[model samples]
Target: MEIKIIVDAMGGDFAPKEIVLGAIKALKKDRNLKIILVGDEKLINPLLEQESSDLNVEVVHTDQFITMEESPKAAIKEKSKASINLAMQLLAENQGDALVSAGSTGATILSAAKFLPVIPGIERSALATVLPTARLHPGNHGISLLIDVGATLHCTAKQLVHFAYMGSYYVSHVLEIPRPRVALLNNGTEETKGGEVLVKTYRYLKEAPNLNFIGNIEGTDILKGTADVIVTEGFVGNIVLKTLEGASEILKHAGRYAYRKRLTWKVGLALLSSGVRQLKKRTDYSEYGGAPILGFKKLVIKAHGRSNAKAIANAIGVARQSVEQNIAEHIGDSIIEFNKQHRLDFIDI
Candidate 1:
C-alpha cells in the first residue's frame, strides 16, 4: 500500500527548508511513499526546483499560517485555510493518509481535536511519545509509549485508566508490543503511595482484566524498563519531559566547561564525547519526531517547534507506521468494547 503524507511546510521555525528537505529524504528512502507539501507554493516550488530530484513530492498552496503566540481557537476560527487546518482537512478527505507539522503544539492539538475529532467514548485525546528504557529482558530493548506527555492538564481517576487502556492498545497495535504492561507514575512502588487520583487509578487498573497492570512505578523506574506504558496527567508528564531536556542541556554545558578547564580533562572529554552524544541522542524526543494525538479520526502528529529535517522525517515514518497498523480502526473497536462492558455515562463527568 502506498503511504500518503501531508507536510505543513510553513508550520515550523525553519518553514519550507526543513520540511521540504525532510520530504525529499523520505521520498528518496521510500519509493511507495507520496508526500504533499502544504504551504505557499511560490516559496516552496522555487526551493524544490533547487533539489532537482524525481521524488514523489507535490506542493499544495496555502497562504494562511498560525503563529506560535496566537490563540488556538482564534487562529482556527479566523484562518480556516491555515496550513495546519488544510493538512488535517486533506487527511479527513483521504487526500493524505497522515499529517505532520512542527507547529504550535496547542494549535496542533486544538485543530486536530476539532477537525479530526476523537474515537467515540474517548473523552479526550493525548500526545503519546516513545521513550527508550534500560534493556532488562529479551524483547524489551525497544521504545515504550508515554501518554499525556503534554496534552490534558488535569484528569480523573477513570480518565487515567482510560489513558492506560488507550496507551496499551497503541503499544500493542502500533508498536507491536504484545501484552504491554501499564503503570501509574508515583513516588513509590507501594500501592499506598501517591495522591487520591493515583490511588483510585491504581485500584481501577487492577480490575481491568484486559490490561497487564503493574502497580505503581517511581520516577526512576521510568528509565529502568519497569513498564511498557506509563500513564499520567499532562501536568506531571510535561514537567518530567521538560526537566529531562533541561538536564541534558546542563550536562552538555558542563562537558564544554570541563573540556576548556584543563588539558587532562580535555583529553578525557574527547574520549567521552561519542558516548555523550549517544546518551543525548537516546534521551532526545526529537529522534522520535513527534507525538501522535491518539484516538483522533486521522493520524495527526505534533512535531517539536525546534524540529529539523531528521525530526520531520521521523514524524513521517511514525505516521506511515500508524497508518499501516490501522490505529484509527483499532481505537474505534476498543472504545466500542470498553463501552459495552462498562457504563461510561456515569464516568463521563
Candidate 2:
C-alpha cells in the first residue's frame, strides 16, 4: 500500500527546515511513500529548491501558523488554515493516510479531535509512546507502550481499562506480540494498593478475558519489562516520561565528561562508543519517531516539538507502520467488545 503522510511543516520550534529535511530523507528511503507538506508555500519552496533531488513530495500552502504560546482551543477555532489544522483536515479528507506534526501537543490533540475525531465508543484519544526494557520478559527486546502520557488527566476505572484494551491491541499489532500482558502502574504488587481508581481498574482488568492482566506493576518493574502494556492516567505517565528523558540527558552529559577527562578515559570511550550509541538509541523517543494519538478516527502522530530532521523522518516511518498494522481498526473493535461486556456505570468518575 502507498502510505501518504501529511506533515505540518511550520509547526515546531524549527519550522519548515526540519520538516522539509525529514520529508527528503523519508522520500529517499521509500519510493512508494508520498509526503504532503502543509505550510507557507514561499518559505517551503525555496528550501525544496535548495535540495538536489526531490522525490515523492508535494506542498500544500497555508497562510496561518499556530504558535506554541497560543491556546489550543482558541487556535483551532481561529486558525482553520494553520499547518496542524490543515494537516488534520487532509487526513480527514483521505488526502493522506496519516498526519504528523512537531507542533503544540494541545493544538495537535484539539485539532485532531475536532477534525478527525476519536473512534466511535472511544472516550478520548490517548498518546502512546514506547519505553526500553530488559530482554528477559515479553515485549523486552523491542519496546513497551505507555498510554495517556499527559493527555487525559482525570480518568475513571473503566477509562483506564479501555486504555489497556487499546494499548494491548497496539502492542500486539504494531510490535507483533501474540498476547501482550497489560499492567496498571501502581505503588505496589498487591491489589489493595494505589488509589480507589487504580484498585477498581485492577479488578476490572483482572476479569477482562481479552487482556492479559498481570496485576499491579511498580515503577521498578517497568524497566524489567514485567508487562507489554502499561496503563496510567496522563498526569503520572507524563511525569514518568519527563523523568526518563532527564535521566537520559544526564547520563549522556556524564559520558561526555568522562570522555574528555584523560587518555585512559578516551580509550575507554572509544571502545564503548558503539555500545553507548546503541543504548542511547534504545532509550530515545526520537528513534520510535513519534507517539500515536491512538483511538482516533484517523492516524495522528505527535512528534517532539524540538525534534530534528531524523526524528521527523522516524515519525513518518511510525505513521506508515501504524497504518500497515491497522492499529485504529483493532483498537476500535476491542473497545466495542469491551464496552458491550462491561457495564459503564461500574466506573464512576
Candidate 3:
C-alpha cells in the first residue's frame, strides 16, 4: 500500500528549503511513500528539484500560510487558504494517510481540531510527546510519554482523565509496550495533591480499566522514568516540556562558549565527550521526530518549528509508521469500548 503523507511545506522556521529537503529524504528512504508538500509551488520546486531524481513527491501550491506572530484562531479563520489549513483539509478529505507540520503549535492544534473530528467519546485531544528518562523500563528503551504538552492549555477533570488513556494507548500501540505504566503528574505523590481537578483526574485514571495506573508522580520523577505515561493538564505539561528544551539549549550554548574561550574548558569537554554524546542521543528532539496530537480521527504530527531536514524527515517517518499501525482506529476502538462499558455518551467535563 502506498502511504501518502501531506506536509505543510510553508510552516516552519526553514520553510520550503528544509521542508522540501526533508520530504526528499523521506521519499528516498521508502519507495512505497508518496509525499505532498503544500506551499508555494515555485519556491518548493527549486528546492525539491535539487534533491531526488524520479521522486514520488507532489507539490500542492499555496502561497498563503499562518505566521508565528498571528493568533492561531484568528489566523485560521481569516487565512482560509493558508498552507497549514489546506494541508489539514487534504487529510480530512482522505487525500493523505497522515499529516506532518513543523508549524505553530497553536495553529496546528486549532487547525486540526477544526478540520479533524475527535475520536468517539474522546472529549478533547492532547499533544503527546516522549522524553528520555534516566531509568530504562524493560522494552521501553529509556523514554516516557507525557501528554497535553500545550494542545489545550487548560483541561477539566474528565479531559485530563481522557489524556491518561490516550497516552497509555499511544505508548502501547506506537512503542509496542504492553500494559504500560501510567501516572498523573502532581505536586505530590499523594492522590490528594494538585487541587480538586487533578485529584478527580487521579481518581478517574486509577479506576480506568485496561490501564496500568501507577498513581501520582512528582516533577523529579519525570526524567527518572517513574512511569511509562505521565498525564498533566496542558498548561503544566507545556511548561515541563519547555523547561527541558531550555535546559538542553543552555548546556549546548555553554559548551560552545567555553570551548571557544578557554583551552582548559575545551579539554574538559573533550574528556566528557562520551557522556555528552549519550546525553545528545537521549535528549535530542530531532531523534524523536515530533509529538503526536492524540484523539484526532486522522494522525497529525507536530514537529518542532526549528526542525531541520533531518527532524522533518524523521517526523514524516513517524507519521508513516502511525498510519501503517492504524493507530487512530486502535485508539478509537478503545474509546468506543470504554464508553459502552460505562454506558455514557461522553465523559462529563
| Cα error of candidate 2 at position 135, Å | 2.5
Lowest lDDT 10-residue stretch of candidate 2 = 340-349
Structure candidate 2, residue pairs in collision:
none
lDDT of 1: 0.83
Go through the candidates in order and give the clash count of each. Answer: 0, 0, 0
Instruction: Kindly list the per-residue Cα lDDT of model 1 for residues 1-349, writing each as its tens digit.
Output: 7899999998888887888888887787888999999999988888788875787888889888998889988998899999998888888788998899999888888878777867777787888878888887565755778888877989888678778888998788777789998999989988878888888778778877588998998898877787899999999888887886787689879888988999999999889889878877887777876878887778888888888888889889888888898887777776666656667533643
Error of 2 at 336 (Å): 0.7
Which order, best to worst by lDDT?
A: 3, 2, 1
Which of 1 and 3 is ahead in TM-score? 3
lDDT string for model 2 (291-349, tens) is 88887877888989988899999999888888888778888888888777776656464
TM-score to native of every candidate shown: 0.92, 0.91, 0.94
Q: What does the lDDT come to for candidate 3?
A: 0.88
134 in model 1: Cα distance from truth in Å? Answer: 3.1
Instruction: Output the TM-score of candidate 2.
Output: 0.91
TM-score of 3: 0.94
